[model samples]
Target: MATEDLMRKALEALGEVNGPMSIEVIHRLVDAGDVEDPMSIAEVSDLLDVSAHTLRYYEKIGLVTVDRDSSGHRVYGPESVRRLVFLTRMRISGMAIRDLQHYVELVDAGEGTVPE
Candidate 1:
């Protein structure tokens, strides 16, 4: 196969992970275009079948922070993308929304909680 054709196939393998990342962090991951990072929101959505609004809500409630690009666009790095996958999986495991929020709060507080 030609080099160009191989590259094209590789990009195609990227699939929905390629563009339309719903969250900033996810976008950054996709933009980064490396396995070391997370894929874009579009990729995550395609991978997990979740809606963009769900991710937006996660950001709204401080569950996720998507860094912005110079153009004021959200950029998602590998960590954020990985976190998304984890959170999505947690939801699937019957984790309550409040628990998730608490977990996020602990993370925000540098892994310390107010104690039971």
Candidate 2:
């Protein structure tokens, strides 16, 4: 899918939330299956409407994990792209960074947090 399209869907996914919603946005976007081949950092950055520095920051904070190519350039795979989209949507929804970190922590914890 095109970057713009991905971004649009990401924004759209936020509508399912009224307020203080859970992380269903991630599952919704991920299950949408917009996975394309792995994309470069610039490409994913442009798609997500974020800067490279911001992407690096996301990684630094463990909000996302981007794989590196042989040359060490960050390559965003499909899962990573989906995650970035979700994270972008969450940020746009005014979710606090710490809250997002907690959400990520919950997600990383897997099915146990589903009841949260």
Candidate 3:
């Protein structure tokens, strides 16, 4: 798929997710661009089909908070990206939110261990 077309699909995926977008959107966002750092909330949501509101809830309870952009939008750097991926996996595995928050705090603290 084309780059722009992919981005649109990503935006749709991470968006309200009111409905499903084409599978191409998932494909493109997953590998589009040379994003060295993690994606913004919008970007992650688009790529991962997550709701920013859910992400925000994670942040609210200290699940994640790498930083924010100049516009005060949640800015998830590369580390955040990796953590989100892990979080998503855990969620899929049926981990509870409280447990996820604790795991996130450990990551923010540079533990990078345990939860095994």
**RMSD to true structure for each model, in Å:** 10.7, 8.3, 7.7
Higher-TM-score candidate of 1 and 2: 2
lDDT of 1 by residue, 44-71 (tens): 5555556778887888888888877677
Clashing pairs in 2: none
Worst window of 10 by summed lDDT in candidate 3: 16-25
RMSD of candidate 1 to true structure, Å = 10.7
- If the candidates were sorted by their lDDT against the true structure, best first, what order would they fall in? 2, 3, 1
Worst lDDT 10-window in candidate 1: 21-30
Per-residue C-alpha lDDT of model 2 across residues 14-115, encoded as one tens digit per residue: 663443333444345444348689998888766665689988998999999999989999989989988888888778668988998999999999998998
What are the lDDT scores of the predictions, listed in order? Answer: 0.64, 0.76, 0.66
* Superposition error at 58 for model 1 (Å): 0.4
Which structure among the candidates has the greatest lDDT? Answer: 2
Tell me how many clashing residue pairs each candidate has: 9, 0, 4
C-alpha TM-score for every candidate: 0.59, 0.71, 0.59
Which clashing pairs does model 1 show?
Answer: 24-74, 24-75, 24-76, 25-75, 25-76, 26-76, 28-76, 29-76, 38-78
